[model samples]
Target: MKPVLIRLLLLLAWAPFYTQAQQRFSFEIEGGHFLKDGKAVPIISGEMHYPRIPHQYWRHRLEMLKAMGLNTVATYVFWNLHETEPGKWDFEGDKDLRRYIETAGELGLMVILRPGPYVCAEWEFGGYPWWLQNIPGMEIRRDNPEFLKCTKRYLDRLYEEVGDLLVTRGGPIIMVQAENEFGSYVAQRNDIPLEEHKRYNAAIRRQLADAGFDAPLFTSDGSWLFEGGTTPGALPTANGESNIENLKRVVDQYHGGKGPYMVAEFYPGWLSHWAEPFPNVSASWVARQTEKYLQNDVSFNFYMVHGGTNFGFTSGANYDKDHGIQPDMTSYDYDAPISEAGWVTPKYDSIRNVIGKYVDYVIPEVPAPNPVIEIPSIRLTGIADVLAFAKRQEPVESPVPLTFEQLRQGYGYVLYTRHFNQPLAGMLEIPGLRDYATVYVNGERVGELNRYYNRYSVFVEIPFDATLDILVENWGRINFGEEIVNNRKGIVGPVTVNGMELSDWFMYRLPMDGAPGPDKTAEVRAGTPEASFLHRKPVLYTGSFNLSETGDTFIDMSAWGKGIVFINGKNIGRYWQAGPQQTLYVPGVWLKKGENRIVIFEQLNDGPKNEISAVKVPILKELKS
Candidate 1:
């Protein structure tokens, strides 16, 4: 025998011995059922994102899942969350993926790793780093070489961190997803050729294997998009509403009447976008689905067992066929079995009871609910003007309007100022106003252009020579649709005044992420002494209160128009009183006893009184759609 063949044969001879010594469990597919150590087993999994929840609460959430009769925990590893800036990966704090996986294993639960270069979980830029937008000839989630190179680099780093945790390496991770719902995505898009889509899937799978993932690779697609999204050699799984027969059909068709069917994303509850009421999938409906899967001996995973908060400007928007530019609210509390605040709900009981009937394993009692603190109302004073604060930011001069990425701005708002040379009047057209913009003449609010309403240009009547300011807020990038490619924020084209192209523009990038607090209030006052609430400029409201105890609470923003909030120097999330989500969730882990600080950067504060209140429970279901 050849030396290489002899060595390989010897390694294979010792494989079982080594695996046994390592206490490694064999997880694979046999016939049509998931088998563990050659015994048929069903995977009862629930989806959770570690970054969305506090690092301290991982175990608690895992325990909740386990108590609810889940044997596995599936999680999506967000690329953007880890690689926010190119070449700079952040796995510390809540972004730690290895720790999360190990914690699940320690809880006696298996894990299915869904590490996506593009995780379309209503996440900003669909989990692609915003910096990728500036790359030359970069096309995301497709067969672009530049995009694939960046993806490979990220995957290489990811595998280095958690690849050893796979089942073959004696870790609890049994399977690693090839990519998130790719078959469904490339199905209807004409921009990508079907052959190229298949090649891309094959390339990603090859890359994963090269990175040393020995476990089974799988692709998730909606039943309708199974043909296009499925990889030729990998396991194919379907996701959708409670329809077991349809799921089986999709799996069977993909596998050539083979077994081992799986539903990757079984939606117990749906995601709620801004302005739309929270989607409340009935507990009985969830129970019925859970029962059906258990009865049919089918392996399934809940889309969100615990949909946590989408902190900061990480929330995404959806461009629907019927509704245009629908932005997602910051509160990701998807009304799941485990609430965003880490508490169990009625759905928990329903699902637990249903699963208990089919399984012989005892389901533990649900843990006691955490104590919720009701904070008294906090009075906030308008401390500074945002434009006044903008003086510190070095302005970029441009003849035409610039996109946010063009000026190295990631999120939040941007200010485009132009000093009028002569008296100008008529329609001020920003042909490519990416989303929402507030038009101001000489610092006075005139009109607003909205992307959702398809209202772009606004009539500006400049009486005399005055400065024109268009403060644009990036509502959100479209997370899913054909509009994903053209989802650049700010102005992507020229700004015209009465059919005349305007030049000599002063662009100020307002990425108000880490704005200074009360100490910097003096700077704004010094910059614009005449700045007042009467003016339509952005306002930074500062307030501090003493907390006797720290617990989960919802900061009420029913009175506020639209803005983002910061508590104790940490960004809580954005809030808009447009009905659905009226409050932002404040995790107890973020708060401290004694003096606590809050700063609000209100884009449009409709105020007779600038104040905020906190309640004990989260307002999960929206009162209006």
Candidate 2:
């Protein structure tokens, strides 16, 4: 043992193959034409943001990536994630990006780092700190001096953290993408010419150079990703282009010849929203693309090998106004080969089968799939009454208006309280009510807004000396697109009543935590989502099952409204009544026999009571099956 240890210590090359492997890398397109070492390496990679998976599961997730026949793991360097606050940084917790890099190396995988100070990955503020938005005349992504200053700061910090992880430094990072799909949104910018693109890349280039990091820099964009994206230096990048000729355009247009070609984001399955059905593309179609890429030696990266959660308010939405997609569910389940929980799907197996039959490498057996058991449905009734506890003791003043930011609360509800001038009631218009709102006159519920539709309405009646109160909840910010850049919570703008804009609002905050606060349970009074079922402001219910032994189970979500679920004490994820997500995956780790507590906090009411149980099968479509 001593001799072996000495020999191993003496041979420093004992590091993993990825850590010791060296390759000159470049991007080519279509037909597996990307060349490395003067030959096509025909890379197969998967995108899994480091912050998405829990650190404990990093290696597990990487192993899963490798098992999927992926030779590379791409991750985004979420600036906001690293630097939670400006000038301050945290590389631990979910921010341990350095570990993410080293782990990839250890797993014999390559790395593609996307360190966008403006990484628009459906993150809050597109990865910008909220304080940046408060800056005067501040602009993000493009060339705003404030934005540039901040970007540089983040770059400096990043270099200090993991610059050595580059392949040039004998690490797994073979390539780095400048920004994702920048050309897709160039028109919204200041309409600057290509020179603007040059300036951005130039600054990045300068930073990398100054850091003594010479791992080969490249910018990636579509054949036209260059239009809005930083061009010249950025490697030409594309996604989901199955045709060899189409990829040729990107490489030919940029490299003028051929080198390393890659699909930075190859979409296999699509993402689904609250109301929409699953956005599933055929697994066979995706398998064919993978087969072609490898057969032709084209290197590619799956857009999301694992799409993690948009926890809190960071979920970005499509079109700027909708915060649905970006904030993705609490589940980072991208419907990729790998689910958010690091479980490999059938897509993974299909992709792996072809790679095994066709490629030179052999991947190990995957960790056993999570336990899935069906819990016999339980009828849940009025365990106890739930209702609101009044906090304001004084005579409530005129209608008070409060903005989302002023509330000092990130997500959830905000209360605006003010006294009316005289006996009055008319069509109430909350023009500045940003996302979602629930109108209550004198502590009685009157109306609500879906926000996704931009409107939810009802009539209002007031008595003499009436107190005006409108509670607007920051349901969620739009999780994708340009709108995500400015996603603020609560009543973003203002609250209006009739023709007058309410002012001097007294405020109340309702984050509601997860599920419902049990102590605030209301008497089971009503039975519809539109009515107040809980007489209490918050509600809580508890149930226990003696397992004697714990087993994996699928908590059927068909019976519950929108709320969160907990086992023992871990948050599984948010649950919505909306289908096709009728089940929540619950690992047995959080459960215990002899009496594990299950608590539920449902905000809206659709029925008098509900039921929950476990399932032996995955309730989701295609991917799980």
Among all candidates shown, the one with the greatest TM-score = 1
Clash totals in order: 4, 69
Candidate 2 residue lDDT tens string, 173-291: 77766655666656454465666755765665666566555655555555556555645554576666677777866666676566566677788766655555566667787888888
Model 1, position 591: C-alpha lDDT score: 89
Give me the runs in candidate 2 sitting further than 4 Å from their true place.
1-40, 190-194, 208-213, 308-314, 320-327, 373-400, 419-421, 465-469, 511-553, 565-572, 587-599, 606-611, 614-625
> Candidate 1 regions off by >4 Å?
1-24, 523-535, 620-625
Candidate 1: how large is its RMSD?
5.2
**C-alpha RMSD values across all candidates:** 5.2, 6.4
Cα lDDT tens digits, model 1, 494-584, are: 8887788888889887787875666666423312344454456667878778898898889987777778899888888888767578888
lDDT of 1 at 563: 84
Best by lDDT: 1
